[model samples]
Target: MEILNSKEMIYSPTENREEKLSITGRVTFLSMVAGSVLALTNFISNSALAEDVIKIGTPLALTGGLADEGKKQQIAYDMWLRRVNAAGGINVGGKKMKVKLVAYDYQTDGKRAGQLTEKLITSDKVHFLAAPFGSGHTKITAGVAERHGVPIVASTASSLSVYNQGFKNIFGTLAPNTGMTEAMMKFFKKKLPGTQKVAVLGRDDVFPRAMAKSLSKGARNRGFDVVYDELYAVGTLDHASSLSKIKSEKPDWIYLTGYTQDLILLRKQMSDLGVTAPIVTMVTGPAYKEFVDGLGKLADGVTSSSWWHHATDYKSDDVFGSTKAFYTQFVKEQGHDPDYVHASAAAALIVLQKGIEKAGTLNRAKVRDAIASLDIVTFFGPIKFSPNGMNQVRDLPIIQVQKGKVSVLHPADIKNAEMQKM
Candidate 1:
């Protein structure tokens, strides 16, 4: 398998022996060059060997609509790789085994992603697997992993539907979609009790639509009038028609759910169409700094909720030790603030590492059991998998962008600022 993000730290094991040959062309060994040739040959031989290593295969959408999110995942994985190698790798049966990540670019095609996942298991013989970007592609990869009896972790998938399937080999780092949606509904209702009318908009995809349905349910439960609800087609460039309808409904709050790019365009459309709401909250857009920096003044007062934030204070027994430490190192290395996506992706890798270490072996079933029964906290937060392999942590951070600052507003303990009303 081709390694898309090796970066010198990660390992790439090849099936063909010919590919491992380092010395090319004609090489004549003289009396003086004998020692140098022997040293170079030994170095090449050691680097080519993949023994005593743990290989985890992942399919990434490196060149498509999901490329930005995919790059975040790669960075998180590489961070884990560097840290693990620095600590002499994971302890397995009293031996510290180095890690090798085998990543393949699926080009954002769901079918190709599934094929690559299966190839990783059968052909590449990867010990574990990390699913693709979001719920839609992850479900496909998870199914393939299940059929092959390989344990797989999903960092970005949160839709309850993906976890509802009776799969024995799938686990996710993020909690169910209901977790974020429920947290947001309670926060909004408590902060602005007079917000009776709510409007919901989302992408017509697996995760966004599922999150919208969960948000709609939570909104109604909080005694709010669901004035308007709609799902736009994927890759929709013009949201003027949908914004006009929501504006006519005169809702007090607008809840939107979609990817980073999709929400960026949708927010610009809302501004162009004069759609105003007292509390305009988006599920995941504001989690990244690009959202605020992209729209200087328009992103003000736009609130969002995420599974984990760098501002969270938590201690972990993992490599990073604490949330603050991870954030510090991530910013130092990446030269920018990491978002919820980066946190979740790193958490997924942490889960696998803990499982392999706890089980004391590389057996798939044993590691899977260790992962499912884990009840520990990490830099990301408490991660305990339910029977269906979905994270049970519900300590979501309610956030808002006020004057270009992403601030936490709710869950009083971590609130750095109050929610700014428009």
Candidate 2:
């Protein structure tokens, strides 16, 4: 009699009756073999399904001028990833799916950022995308995401120019640049009635240029004379020429808009040149701890605005609990306090997750629509996108560095302290 095995067939003598199987026994054995095969097939199918995960592609400036901010953005996303995975991943269409982030270092080059974004969508086949840091990089990458019909939540871009391009797939966490300076201008008008003359200086970049122009217009509208408004070239180390002109103008208020390192240098140059303005407001640097760490006492009385703050008491029904809780968790994970940049980055991720959960499907169009219609408040603050796909629910909080700490100066309702004179 011959018995069939997986690899070969073997012939056995009838004398070995104990080892040889009877006809009925052979049929039973075959039934067990068939059942084992079916079980193995099912196990493989289930394993494949269980391995399914949502991948989010991100391009960050991990080794260039924007490295500090880009690293902060990564940290923010990492925090969200830990929390979501710990809670058994995101519930999508009644199935729990883990998330995987595919990130690349674009080295702060806008063109490289755009190329990486396209590669992420086409090659990596990511389900969603996160915008790169800064307006220039975000704008470049956003165009790629828009062309592919992929929704991207921009974390650090506040330039209105980026959102004005009619890209329906793009959404921003920060308010427009114009909105950032509105509260500060109104506060100056009501609080410092005598402040009139103003000088605006910004880096020759998309965001800083737009921010300076917006601040100049806002100041002029608020009854302040625009003394001197100029833009210095990017990477301009010596601002003596500009500072000399600004000093001659003797402006009552000076608004400086630039990146963190640029602003830090500009502040030091202002001190070196003995250029003094009674009211000094920087667009973004002063709100970050690096600025204070870079200038120490020099950072005092320097006012800036931000999209979110850790001191906020806003409540949320999201994963981070409340504003205070978010801050607490961020400190625990990162070993330091989070700034507006971190909050904005984290909020962008939160907004994306909320949209996915609401849509209950991975359909791109449905998730995009869900994000467009979002009106919920999170730990970052109220988040609602306008028809232009820019966040409209949260107002920028004006903050001034006082005694080595950030103090909210405007929107009296949430203000932690009054602005002190420089």
Model number with the top TM-score = 1
> Which number leads on lDDT?
1
lDDT of 2 by residue, 1-422 (tens): 11122122111222133234335877557655654555566456645753577778898888777888888898888888888888887778787788777787888788888888888798667789999888888889999999999999999888888899999999998888788788778887777888889999998999889999989888878778999999999879888899899999998898999888898988999999998887898878877888899988888889998877777788997778899999988888778889987898889989998898888888889999999999988999989999999998445788999998889876777889977777
Per-residue lDDT value at 294 in model 1: 82
Instruction: List candidate 2 stretches off by more than 4 Å.
Output: 1-51
Q: What's model 1's lDDT at 268?
A: 90
**Cα RMSD (angstroms) for every candidate in the order listed:** 4.9, 12.8
Report the CA-based lDDT of candidate 2 relative to the real structure.
0.83
TM-score of each model, in listed order: 0.89, 0.87
TM-score of 1: 0.89
Alpha-carbon error at 271 in model 2, in Å? 1.5
lDDT of 1 by residue, 68-134 (tens): 8888998999998889989998999899998878898888889989988877787667899998799
Per-residue error for 129 in candidate 2, Å, reads 0.5
- Per-residue error for 268 in candidate 2, Å, reads 1.5
